[model samples]
Target: MILDDFLIYNTNGLYCKCGDFYLDPQVPVTHAVISHAHADHAVASNNEVYCTEATAAFMQLRYAKNAAKVFNIAAYHQSFVVGGVAVTFISAGHMLGSAQVLMEYQGTKYLYTGDYKIQPDATCEPIEWAKADVLITESTFADPEVLHPDPVVEIKKLNDISLNIMLGAYSLGKSQRLINLITEHAPQKTILVHHRIMPINQVYERMGYKPGKYQIYGRKLMKQQGGFVYIVPPFTFDSYARAKDVKRLFASGWKNLQVNKQDTLFISDHADWNDILEAVKQVQPSQIWTLHGDGRHLKNHFNNDIFVKLLS
Candidate 1:
């Protein structure tokens, strides 16, 4: 690797010593390279941030306009030299403007897959494949037992429910994806979003991603009768637990511990076990470093076949 020992995880997050920058640092850093606008990946207190245009917009929405001291927005596939390392942002298809950080130095390419998905969605860019010497990937759904059912099937199930449904999701990426799914599969039902998701959804639409029709959630809507769909962040659902006609459906790869009786919608914005395996075969990286989640399944499954290690 051209960066050699510089590209390593430290107390904060992925730091590039030579470049004097961090990739998705957990805490505030002098220079941070954000992969997406997700809360866990993109924080508000950075001195400087480098990310895709849409990510910057989402960051502004999430953290307000003054989230960082300096924000540098890059177009997809555009390369910018950062402290002698050539860097490019490729679409990750995880969320609006989510990107895989590609760094090349001394002719060696390292690709960091920051929460990507191969599944196509109308609201964001599709995943793009590239060759790299090393692949730093997320294993959020790497277990063999985890197979994401076809989205059409899952969305169909959501459409079939008779009661007024309370669909819970992350306010950023997941909720927007669900809104699109609900639009395509269940056009007849009314779609309402929490105030938390409303601003981000507007940002997505302003970024030219049209996820069809949806309205903002209101207390008055909760009193409505019949089979309407209310999509909100998980906590928003908790605020309305006593609604009589509401049937809860939590949308995520994992189950919600707090809402035990609620149904799981099995909607994942990350790659599942099969998708991760497919990524391995396609990327053809010489060495694999697994981070995020347990990081065990990919390491165990590909150890004998390829060079693999759990970084986290």
Candidate 2:
């Protein structure tokens, strides 16, 4: 469907095209409005980007020299005119500076929710529901059976398994959530983080979020503690031969599938089935378009008015 003069296409990533305006340039969109700095959600090829300041900094660090015009929009509800369309951003609560985009054109309002979670997290602002004529959302954990343990309870259990257990997750969003959870519940425990995640951790700290005491991974740090919680990117396990002695736990919605326990965990940054239903009820959008992960399964349980589309 066309909104204003923009053409909307569901690209492989969390990207949408409106005429020459694209929200994310994972592929190729003239104008991109990024929801966050996740690698999959934001690509450097896009010429123009509209996102929160945190996301812009992240993109710049990773995709240096990319001639992308980035416009910083605060996490609060604020509107900007892009290509004659009014666009606004609201908190998504998935990570620091994550936002949900609201686009209005020709009196029609459309809300696009990037990866989001309704549960209140201390590390980030809570997700805010906004009224929209068409709402696009993520259904990462759409199945009712795919419920996640409470953040507090799960972190404790994870800590109990092994004080030195290394959690495997995306270095950006999931890692921050795990850090905050550990700090709030297991503040006494020393948290070790990978070198790649250290930079982002600093940003989180600057935002006034207490991330607990953490050290960068190295021989000296590793030898100092035998039972400390460590957070690392999922790719770390690819070279598990070096980490054979360390117990590794994977965390993501992909863990819900009956896969190898060593491969994934049920901890996800996105809202699960219960959270999705609650969000839909709270937002009460006229129509729903699901994106990311297993959206079809989640849409089956909802009314026909809710439209389900997979992220191509």
Candidate number of the best TM-score: 1
Q: Report per-prediction Cα RMSD to one decimal.
A: 1.8, 3.2
Top candidate on lDDT is: 1
Residue range 27-85, candidate 1, lDDT tens digits = 99999999998889998889999999898988887778668989999998899988888
TM-score, cand. 1:
0.94
Residue 39 CA error for candidate 2 (Å)?
A: 0.7
TM-score for each candidate, following the candidate numbering: 0.94, 0.86
Model 2 scores a TM of: 0.86
lDDT of each: 0.84, 0.71
Once fitted onto the true fold, the runs of candidate 1 whose alpha carbons sit more than 4 angstroms away are: 1-4, 257-262
